[model samples]
Target: MIRIAVIGQSGSIPEEVERMAEEAGAEVARRGAVLLTGGGSGVMEHASKGAKEAGGLVIGILAGDRTDVANDYLDVPITTGLGFDFRSLILVHSCDALIMIRGGNGTLGELSAAYMNCKPTVAIETSGGWAEKVKQTAFEGCYLDERRTVEIHYAHSGKLAVDRAFELLASKWNEERNTGVTGD
Candidate 1:
């Protein structure tokens, strides 16, 4: 299954942002994709909740060994015990694409990781925080830096964000297949 990870802030968030996260998760499920997250609070919790409500599988890449800290909606918790920064890499590396919501430094790090790995990313601009800031500050409103390793896509709504991610994944898959890479 296509695995999509939603990365965002872990603390309290505005109600609308929560709703956006939920919609993104639900859209991921409706598209028959597995949802992955940092598995903490705030955006992670809300996304997991939405995925669960939609009967989607949720995987939480947790930083600590204690699954108790993971959100209640997780179908499986991969307790990495790798701490925040390292676990963030695991989250990025494990997913086919990433959906970014309102976030802080942690989210920025994840975005950087995605770029470095050439992983497809969709940022929900209307959710505010880095999701919004990244669009304005991105190089030519696309690449993060001069390297232009991978361009990040922006979406104004949750469903659109997920839709964009799927489109990106499909294109990437097609490109790999055309090149006879198999993408395994």
Candidate 2:
């Protein structure tokens, strides 16, 4: 099972973008994939709601120990006591791949962390926010850094973005297995 984290804005997102995020989550669930999120509001809420409705497991990597703020749709809530900044790192580390929707600074931080850790990430570019900024800010269109640690793939729709994510993940795991252990 692939641990797919959904990174996006919390607290009141645009109506259309929120719907896109929900559709993304429903697609994730329908495909039998795990849905992970920061677990607040807006996009996260919609995603979790979609996943739950689709009978998929939803995990929330929350900023604090309190589960009260977490969406009702979550199957499990990881109460990361590290606050927002540090908890974001946990979200990146825990996932095999990530799907980014319309996001803010917090989502951007996760994107950077995913790049640093070589985790494959797919962005729904049509959603806006960091999804739009990343194409311009990335080191070489796709790469987040000059090291070529991980390159972000862009898709026009949530479904396509998820598809790209899985493809990248399979390719990445294959490379990791073939490369084996390296000293230098």
Candidate 3:
């Protein structure tokens, strides 16, 4: 199954953004994909709630070696003792794609990691924070750098973002298959 990580802000966020995150998670679940998150509050919690409600598997790549700080919606909490930054990298590396909602510095770092790892990512453009800002700040409004390893797609809604992410994954897989280059 494809694992799609929802990268976004933690703690106090706009209601609209929370809705978007939840919708994205629900969409991911409905599509039979596992939902991954940082397992904290705000976007992560909201998304996890949606996924759980939709009967989807929710995994949290949590910081530290305890699940006390993780959201209540997680089905599996991976307590990584590697701290926040390292745990974020684990979240990025473990996913096939990512959906970005309203995010701050942590989300931005995840975006950068996704780009570096050539993972497909779709950002909700209207969700604010890095999700909105990166569209203007990124090179050619998509790539993170001159390398252009992967194009960051922007969507107006959570469902659209998840759809776009699946499309991107399909395209990438097709391209790899056509080129006879297994992305192993």
Candidate 4:
């Protein structure tokens, strides 16, 4: 099964952004993919809620060993005990693809990690934060650097972002297969 991580801002967020994250999580569930997040509040909580409501498995890659700090919607809490930055890396590495909503510095770091690892990522362009800013700041408008490792796809809504992530994942897998890269 595909594992899609939703990377975004924690703490207070706009209502519209919350809705977008929730919809994205629901769409991931509907498509039979597992939803992964930082396991905090704001975007993570909203997305987890949507995934749970849609009967999807939600995994939270928490920062500490305490499950109490994680959002209430998590079906499984992976207490990394590695703190936020390291835990974020685990979250990025474990997922096959990512959907970025309105994000802050942490989300930007996640995006960078995704690009470095060549993970398929779809950003909600209208959700604000790094999701919106990355389009203009990225090299040639998609890559994180001159390497052009992976093209970050952009969508206006959560559903579309999830759809694009799936498409990108499919294409990546096909390419890997055609190139004899087994990806094992």
Candidate 5:
């Protein structure tokens, strides 16, 4: 199944931002994709909540060894003992695509990792935080830097962001298939 990770802050997010995160999770579930998260509160908790409500599998890539610290909605808890930064890389590598919501420094690092790994990422611009700031800071409004590793897509809502991510994944798959490349 397509695994989609939702990266965002770990603190108290605004109600509207929470709704967006939940909607993104719900949409991911509705589309028959698994939900992956950092396994903390705020965006992670809400996304897990939505995915569970929609009968979707939810995986939490946790930073520490305590599975109890993860949100209750997780179907599986991957306790990496890698701490936040390193575990973040595992999360990036494990998913087919990512949806970035309102985030802080950690989210910024994940965005950079996604770009470096050439993973498709969609930022919900209306959710504030890094998701909104990235558009203004990115090169040509899509690339994260001069390297231009990959272009990031922007959406106004959670549903749209998830949709765009899937579109990106499909486009990449089609490109590889058309080129007759077996692996990318």
Candidate 6:
């Protein structure tokens, strides 16, 4: 199973963007993909709700040991108790891929980490927050960095973003197959 981490803001956001996030989550579930998120409120909550409605397994990388903070829809809550900052790293590291919704600075940090680790990611570009801002912040008005470590797939709709995410995963898998894993 390919784990997909949905990174985005945890507070107030535009209703349209929130709906997009919800649709993204629903699409992931509809495709039989497991949904992963920071497990807080706002966009995370919307995504989880959509995924659960679609009968998908949802995992929450919670910031604390208590389950109270977790959204109502998570199937499994990994209570790292590591506090927000450290747990965010856990969220980035455990996933096979990431979907970036409209997000804040925290989402920016997740994007940076995903790039540093060469994780495949998709971005819903029409959403707000960092989704709108990051293209400018990235190097060469294109990529996150010179390493080309992580390719950001952009889509105008939630369903399209999730679709592109799967494409990215397929491409990455193909690259690994063709080049072969080096450690062996």
How does candidate 1 fare on TM-score? 0.98
Cα-based lDDT for every prediction: 0.94, 0.87, 0.94, 0.94, 0.94, 0.85
> Model 2, range 29-137, lDDT digits (tens) per residue?
9889999998889889998888888899999999999999998989999998999999999999988889999899989999999888878888988888998889988
The residue-by-residue lDDT of candidate 4 on 1-184, one tens digit each, is: 9999999999999999999999999999999999999999999999999999999999999999999999999999999999999999999999999999989999999999998888889999999999999999988889888978889989999999999999888888898889998654
Candidate 1 — which residues are off by over 4 angstroms? none
Estimate, for each residue in 2-84, the C-alpha lDDT of model 5 and write its tens digit. Answer: 99999998889999999999999999999999999999999999988998999899999999999999988899999999999
* TM-score against truth, every candidate: 0.98, 0.94, 0.98, 0.98, 0.97, 0.94
lDDT of 6 by residue, 1-184 (tens): 7778888989887898789888988989999889999999988999998899988989999989999978899999999999888888999899988889888888998888888877777888788789878877777644787867656767888888888888878877887789996311
Q: Number of backbone collisions per candidate, in order? A: 0, 0, 0, 0, 0, 0
Candidate 4, residue 172: the lDDT equals 82
Which pairs of residues clash in candidate 1, taking residues 3 or more apart in a chain or in different chains? none
Q: Relative to the unseen true structure, what is the C-alpha lDDT of residue 124 in candidate 3, on a scale of 0 to 100?
A: 95
Q: How big is the positional error of residue 151 in model 6, measured in Å on the Cα after superposition? A: 2.2
Q: What CA RMSD would candidate 5 show?
A: 0.9
